[model samples]
Target: MQLQILEVILWPKAAGLPPRRVPFEPGKVNVISGASKRGKSSVIPIVDYCLGSRLCAIPAGTIREACAWFGIRVQTSEGEKIFARREPGKQQSTDEMMLLEDSVLDVPTDTPKKNTTRQAVKHLLDRLAGLSNLGFDPEEPRSGFQGRPSFRDTLAFCFQPQNIVANPDVLYFRADTNEHREKVRTIFPYVLGATTAERLAKKWELENLLRELRRKERERAAHDTVSATWLANLQVWVTEARELGLLRGDALEATEETLIVALEKVLAAGEEGNGFSAQGTGASADEYAALQTEESKIVLDLSVARHRLNQITAVRGTVGYYKGALDSQAARLGVSRWLRTLSNDGARCPICDSAMTSSSGELEQLCDALATIENETHTVSMAPPVLDRDLVDVKSKLSLLEDQLKAVRIRKRAIESRSKAIREGEQTSARVARFLGRVEQALELFSARSAPGGLNEELEKLNDSIEDLRKSLSEQQYALKLDAATARVSKDITRIAAKLDVERKDAPARLDIKELTVGVRDDAGREDFLWHLGSGANWLSYHVAAILALHVFFLRQLHSPVPALIIFDQPSQVYFPQRLTRPTAQSEEDDIGDEDVASIRRFFEAMGKLAAHFKGKLQIIVLDHAGPDVWDQLEAVSLAEEWRGNDYLVPKDWLDILE
Candidate 1:
């Protein structure tokens, strides 16, 4: 991460006046030496505000009033990036920002518009620093800080402000507050190479696996929870499958395992086309309708045939009856023929041979009347020849009709019987279908519960994975490496402190993670906190030592996420509280006293040593009131800005608009 500040740009509020650009060089101690009220201390906050800080803490006076937009150009691995933020007025901060990126960036001659947001810039910066995209809390970033490390979190090591430069209570820049302290603590191991990116990723994986393990374990437990009830239902299901003919060889064993096998067999039977689906009555609606219609037509045809037969038989029987009556009369009238013969014998009784003439005439008359009656009765044709022929045709038709009617009656009975059977079979089929459906449902449930690749297997796998990840990600797992990293940083701190020669410089100095401050331990391992072991000079030197040591360690790591740039604002403030006029050839800092001059010299020298150690891999920016005489002999230092009478972060000409 080589995000070295190229320049701090302040576009003036007055129209048509070009922005003032304060240029800084890379990988060197770029110093901004100026007097008090020259906007030297404001440089840190101005740079922070431009780099996406939420607060506009750029000294709400001349610097804030004179500048319309605050911007910083920094060099990153992706080349130069310009991050400019509009000054927040009557507000803590604004999200409005403008971000520009290219291989080479120049300070804009005209004021740029807010083309992006502070959050967008922060993400760009985070990625530039090799920070992970998973840095934000899923629920809320402000909730617990389990999120990935942010670019701002690393800034706690990057900036050492005036108030923070000598504050022994806090080692990291923003560790004074709880929110910042915890965030820095969380990310320190990552920046120090103790916790690798692989470890963080594995930690996340472990949490997910643990959640999955819990859920699967619950499901496996649920299977146990309902095992007995399901077994009871399984027995019932097996019995149904057999009764529905979905299963074969039907005596139910009713044991749980056997019932499961039975269900599987039933499903197999369904697949083999022997299921209850094949147990239908095989009755068709069209067949039923056709049979019913034929039955009705046959019944009607039978009724018509019977009626025609009755009519023809009645006519024939009547003719025969009349003829028979006539025949009987004619037979009885045969006595008339005998009477006629008797009349012809002279009206004498058949029993007497002789008769009188008068008696014979009277008998003859009676005989004639009787004979006429016999003749008329005997001559009446019971059936004429034509009628007889018609009757014969009628009898033939009647015989044929009787045969047809008999056949129709037989067919109608058959249809009715078949229809009755179909209706009964359909009723039975409906019941069987419904029972089969229930059996299918029960079998599904049974198979799911008794499945082979069950929840227990998945749960076991998840537990195994969780155990592995837990081991890999545990803090104790990285304890030795972390301790080694801390030890190295502490050793550097002790060496750097020795040069500055602060109190307890000979003692072992260590960064107390829990205390979040530097601790110097004497023999018994008891120590004075940096806050307690302090004069102003002591606090300042220790602060510088701790910060520079951390940076050295950061540069040593192959893939440290901390920005390679560290900015110290007004580091010479404790030494030169009033100010130092830029020295000329005749006079070099006439204001300097013997009081702690060597300490300040050693202070810059330790910084110069680290700068020389990691030449091109690191950048150090100092905004101070120290003159050229104070740090000119050091070749590692570069002059970034030399603020004089009216020139500052905000020029005097830029402030005329506010006045």
Candidate 2:
């Protein structure tokens, strides 16, 4: 992608004064060099603000007080786009902005309300830069929350403010925060064509898939542990129940339903032969028998209700499992259909190397299969509601049976108390029968607690899915080839540094891909890095060389997404003794000394040379306090009229336009 700043316009707060405009040329060094406080440094911030910066970084003073809006015109691959942002009020930023599709030379005279938002403008710019589809979740495991590259993120490489241009620790503009620094490090290779957007996305996908795989492994381990414990307990319970004569010998081979039925029979037999004469309790033996029979009927009803409740629960679980399986099948079928469509449109089949034939019969078959899966999923989904209704009815019936059983138990306890006073002979048989009944109920509960059906099959299917994902991840790992790219970037930075004649034994000699820092060789033949280098001159030199070299690398690549522009603010700061407070034109005879003059000239000369070497493929903009004499002799350098005496980004006439 290519971007050239054609102009920067500052709209006045009132209609009487004209908007201030600064024009720039493409593929050349455009220097806005002159005195202090002439808004020379504000250009970079204005460009950044117009580009979708969340906060307006323009210093609060005369410029902010006078200008109603800030705008910029840039020529891109998609033609010229003009972006205008309202002057931030008291807030840190504003979303309101004006966007035009044409090259706007002047700000509109009418009071133009915001027609778009900052995000909308960024989307258009992202499209021009071929980054519309280039985004990934920053929270992915390996990604470390280094957010995806935005147009502004790339601009951090292109623009260097005075505060950052001379800082020894920082290299890129506004990269003071750790998060911003990580974003620069993570996105540098990608912008240089060492990695692609697709590869980056796939890398994140693989990381997520691996995380999910580990989760499934943990889930399977937990299930196995629980299942083993359940099986062991069931076996012990069954053995004890059989020894107690609560279950018959054939009971060990019984299913859940048969076990429940056996428990019911044992419970019924426990109720028989409770010896009590009605005469002693002032009731007849017939009354006692009738009461026992009623009690037996209620117990049977309670047992049946509990069995029905268990069956309803089991059915609900089965239906839920089937529904989930059908839903997964439907999702896979949809993906397959999408892949087939892509294949028909000239994409190669992923499974086979040959061109995919668009067979109508095959397509029809897939469609039919998809339809069947969808129908099955819908059918299974509906079963949950019916099962829920059945569960509610079963619970209601269980509650009613429980109430009846509670009443019968109360009456039997009272009768037994009275019978105990009359007779105690039948107590032994009754006690044995009750113990057998209790044992049978325990066995039935154990059977119900066994492992769920089809667990192993489900685990096998998940394992197959993980294997397929791993295979796909392996195929897409080609995007991580950063070694060769690092070498190329390192070489380019070294070559550019040499061209600029940055003289320090510890100057940058290589670019580190992982740390995103420049490496240098020391006098001891040991390698050092840029952050350890001393002096503001060396810092400025290394910063400029690294940025220019990266742009050069981008120009050489056929698919690089970096814009071909680099903006520098006061790179000649080291040459100046103190901050220049007033506008003073410098000549060759100025007392600035020869070394300072030479260094300034060399900086501009190197920039001009690189711009010429690229042959209209790169644009360089410099903002400084140097006069025309510093760069008048340089070739292909366009010097804007000095911002010293009367010239400035915001005109003097418009200074009083603030309402």
Candidate 3:
């Protein structure tokens, strides 16, 4: 499925440039080369752009910016020719863009000779190269700057400098990229299996895990805020209770011992002032009076101390009771009641346990005691005016904590919901994983066998059968409609990959490449070349090898009607000319090495094999800055035969050169 360019005609009114004619000689390489910017690369876009590749690398300018106003008359098979041309800013008129002739009109319509150039071109691609209808638009003719099919599909793999290597966003198969692994797996399903799909499934699982962890964190934060708020209010209550003599601080201290010792002295003074039961002389009136006053003071101090101890006990009891109640509340609400409490009742029935029971009578008693303590505490805290300030402070703290708790609960719910979604996602992911694995395995098998099953065609056929059966049975089938259009295109590609494997082996490899990845070791226990030699030879081998592999893949797997043309904008980049010791007087020297020439010869030999495979239907356009030697090799192969077609040199004056 090769396309040979016949003649390119430029319309006078189309732009202003004279029509350029380039011929296609059979088996010959049309070497269009000249000084830099002499429209060497421009020739490619000119042909491609006319054949429905809209963004043909030609800059968007006037006629001068384009490769030049050109009309391309391309011959497919037989005498049929497709005439296509484009102006700078007008739509390509369809009247001048259709098939012109047919050779075997009498034959069956399916025969290649009977078809138009357009149809023939499509047939050659589909039958020989296994290509199908390229993404060419039959309607809505292309206006200048109109979007067309992707350049890769339409342009037939042009290797311009911009696409020399690969980039992340560019979805092309590169040897070093992971995508290549998928390609190889698709091509050699027996070896790689469906690993690429499995990798994607793993990514989905990781996403689920992250979602679950976030849920638990939010729950924990809410619990902390609730606990903090409860503790802060308790501290204020304790302080107020202490001030009202309802509670005491530091019960175990030496200050209490001093007070006790002073009380004992006061008792002794009272005994002395009483004069030992009116018998022995004791004290004067002034001493007796002082002793009585001291006695009264000690009694008052003892009473106050007792009151403080009782109040302290009450406050302690109240706090313990409230804490117990909170624990019960939290337990009912599904909070962690065991937190910070070693004696958390372990699954004990509160009704059975006397100590645990929240009896109404006990609750009332505790409430009354709390109220009394609250009243005393509030009085001590207040300045004899409003108790509302202290109540407001407590209320404010509670409100803030409540708000914090509410927010935390909201966050917790959100997290929990997300976690649930993640769990569901995980389940879905698992199902997806299983599905993908099956698909991958199926793809691998499909690739290995090149059978229709991998294409999921059988599934599609089954669905179609089901629909037909349902239509006949009830005249209305809802379930069948859903599954009827679920054909997997990727699977079809895998099936095709498998089918093409038969031709891949023993397909002539590029002979010029230095590195031949072949098999079997030599007598020296080292691998021997199928045909190896030196460095220059190896370079050519690599180049030819690459081209050969691509050629095989393109012919066997690509299913499109576009012309199979390998346009190398700068092939010399790979096949460098030999260095000369003596400076040649000629501006351009012809000194390609013998090894280089031999490698090139190998490439040609490989080409011969491809031509045989393709039946002389391959078009290779090499645009380089070469001397006569390159043409000499091309001529030796009888590639320069007159019937070959045409060639047009883009004179220096035609285009502006970019330095």
Candidate 4:
């Protein structure tokens, strides 16, 4: 993900004038040193806005008033593309933008129309940078824009403005604000490759699967609880069924879960299975008499139905058997009809030349028998139509009779169950009827829960999926990787810290990822954070070292999405702002001695060395008052433009036109 500004373009508010295209050289520390208020500081905000910052923070004096548009032409790995936007009016920002992508781009003589939007371009950049679209917070990613990393988050590494270049507390760009601060920390691991895109995706999947697994487990557990309750509560139903001959077995002998299974099996079997051996016998006097009378009537009807069904079945079988016999005889006798034709052959058989009269008597008798069988076969086949109708009617009546018998038997069992309760000195009937209704409902529910492809099996499947995803995305595994990666980064911080020679140089320095800043060790090996460290030079050194080291690490990785670019605005500001803190301070720190100049030069000198080390792979842009005398001799540094004397960011001619 190589990104560097080829040019910072400014379209003039005055029409028919060419835009100001300030060229920047790659592979060197490009310098934009100038006097204060020369828009040297404005370069950062221009670049940030063109890169799709939410707010247009370009300074609002001459530069903002003079320019019609703010744009930058950048060289990405995908080749050159120009991003230009109209200057904001009353709004904080504008979605209006001009985007061009190709092997070449033409900077318009006039400011172009609004060809795209800020958010649309940001999404395109996110893809261009190879960023992960997934969020780390698996619980609620949709709640806001905070869950995932954006290409914008990588800008923290790319800029160190005046307020930040030597600041003790805030090291990264926009870290002064809480939103950008917290977001950069969360995305630190991802930006450094400690958390891979695949791992992020898997982590989200695992958490979601675990949620589903827990839901299913709860449901399965509830089924378990319900099944347990069924065993105790269902004993009465089992007794009721056994008494009616709808189920067989001692209800007390069955296991809990198996009782639910038994309920399903017996209900599926209905009254057709062998459950009659356990039917009960007994009742109250009046109710017992009525039960007996009803049982007798049902029994009589069942007997009548059974006799009729048997008669229909017997007749059907007789008709079918008679038809079969007649057909068999008809087949045999038909051969005799053909033989009679042979007897009629004009002079006996062709091969056997015996007299026709000799075979005539036998042929005549055979033909007669054939005629008799054919007639009988037709009559028997005709008997089926009427017999089939009668059979169907009888079977239907039998089914109704059987249902009536089962109901009567169930009522009889109910009476007998009451009789037992009566003998136990209790009264029953209406209560038993209500209990039967409840039992019916429970059995249906139990059947569903204990079914084959039920919640338990689904929960088992979800558990398996969750375990598989956790193999790659476990938190413990990620913690170890993050610790190791931070240690690698800490080594870079310490080496660069030594290179800069900040205060307490003997102590080892480490980047505290939790603190989002660097810390130096004391004699007792207790850490001294940036804010706790004494000198402004010390803070400046640590900040520069940590940022440069992060970029080096980013470049070393095969696919670090952070661009190989760092912008430092006035590294000498710490040396100058110190003077400004005084009541007797001047705008120009004229008392600046050789020592102060040397220390300020050291920061640029270190950046210059890394620029040469990385060569074309790294680029640094410094906006400063540190002029040619400081870095002119440094081979790795080059001045892109010096906005001193009469030169400025917005040309004097543009301001003159406004006047």
Clashing pairs counted in every model: 1, 0, 24, 0
lDDT of 4 by residue, 445-545 (tens): 55545567555566677778777877766789888888887888888888877767487667788877777888788899898789998888898888888
CA-lDDT, candidates in order? 0.71, 0.69, 0.37, 0.75
Candidate 4, position 504, lDDT? 68
Residue pairs with colliding backbones in model 2 are: none
Please provide, for model 3 over 212-282, each residue's C-alpha lDDT reduced to its tens digit, 9 standing for 90 to 100: 23443454455446545543433443343344333454532334334333323322222222112221113
Give the top-scoring candidate (lDDT): 4
Q: After superposition, how far is residue 364 of candidate 4 from its true place, in Å?
A: 99
Model 2 lowest lDDT segment of ten: 445-454
lDDT tens digits, residue span 477-528, model 1: 5898889998998899888888885766588888877787788887788887
lDDT assessment of candidate 1 = 0.71
User: Cα RMSDs of all predictions?
Assistant: 51.6, 16.2, 37.0, 31.7
How many angstroms is residue 471 displaced in model 1 relative to the true structure, after the best TM-score fit? Answer: 4.2
Candidate order, TM-score descending? 4, 1, 2, 3
TM-score per candidate: 0.69, 0.63, 0.34, 0.70
Better model by TM-score: candidate 2 vs candidate 3: 2
| Alpha carbon RMSD to native, model 4 | 31.7
* Whole-structure CA lDDT of model 3: 0.37
Task: Report the lDDT of model 3 for residue 252.
Answer: 23
